[model samples]
Target: MKIQEIREIIKLVDGSSIDEFSYEYEGVKVKMKKNGLGNAQQPSQTAIQEPQFANAEEMPTTKPAKETELIKPVIEEQTADLPGADSDYHKILSPMVGTFYESPSPDEAAYVQVGTKVTADQIVSIVEAMKLFNEIEAEVDGEIAEILVKDGQLVEYGQPLFLVKAN
Candidate 1:
């Protein structure tokens, strides 16, 4: 847990023929090893005190020379906590690398959107791989949760295009 303790552990391993050693204290994991050549500088043990055994000791656990700061970042809410958690809305992902087209042409309205109900085998969108336009179909009847990709974007193999909430 502390740098000095870790150094001491390494030193103990280096001084002896112990190839490796590992143990945990109060949920903190520690491990040390000696290389194949056994060339390791062992730390001298002048005085040692186990954390559990020394409750009244006044020594600072971490080094005071190094300034430590804890930081917390703001996070935006995502739908990961929804009922499905790990599962996305039943999606119809891209089968191949291609350009994704929401509509048949530039003039036509997009096929699906958020809350749009889709039937199994419905033509949801098109992916043009190598100049050949391939129809993307929904494999399950569901409502669109989100359109993950934008129109005319280059999609890779197995890339998610739409998120579906099964009906």
Candidate 2:
């Protein structure tokens, strides 16, 4: 349909708990999906699937002779020493895309640091999206092994924030 309508759909999908959404109008179609937590997915702004225009008038009459390949190269992994790699650890992934903060306030100490013991419901950090500040909790009981993200850094959904070693 219209670009504004598509934008509104994207905003609705992003804010809701739904992971995927699709809409169709006449000959046009659109599909969208979110990068859920712990998936290590990159954010995409482009439309996932394109519609096949039914009528000849709706489709472009002249087609290009050359076909374009959209192949992405595989990135090689670097061998760097990671903390808590030897022990049983749980990764705290970002629940949503936002600015991560270690402390509740600018002047206050961080909620939890390396080696700090944390309970399941304990607040470990804050992730701010728009004007709302969301408190992130430690979903598992453990000792903080490493902080993956720096304070005030922009974090993506499913990106690792902290590594916690089980008690």
In model 2, which regions exceed 4 Å deviation? Answer: 1-82, 85-87
- lDDT (CA) per prediction: 0.63, 0.70
**Best-fitting candidate, scored by TM-score:** 2
Which candidate leads the pack in lDDT? Answer: 2
* Candidate 2 C-alpha lDDT tens digits along 51-75: 4566766654432111111111101
Span of 10 residues, lowest total lDDT, candidate 1: 66-75
Clashes of 1: 2
Model 1, residue 58: displacement in angstroms? 67
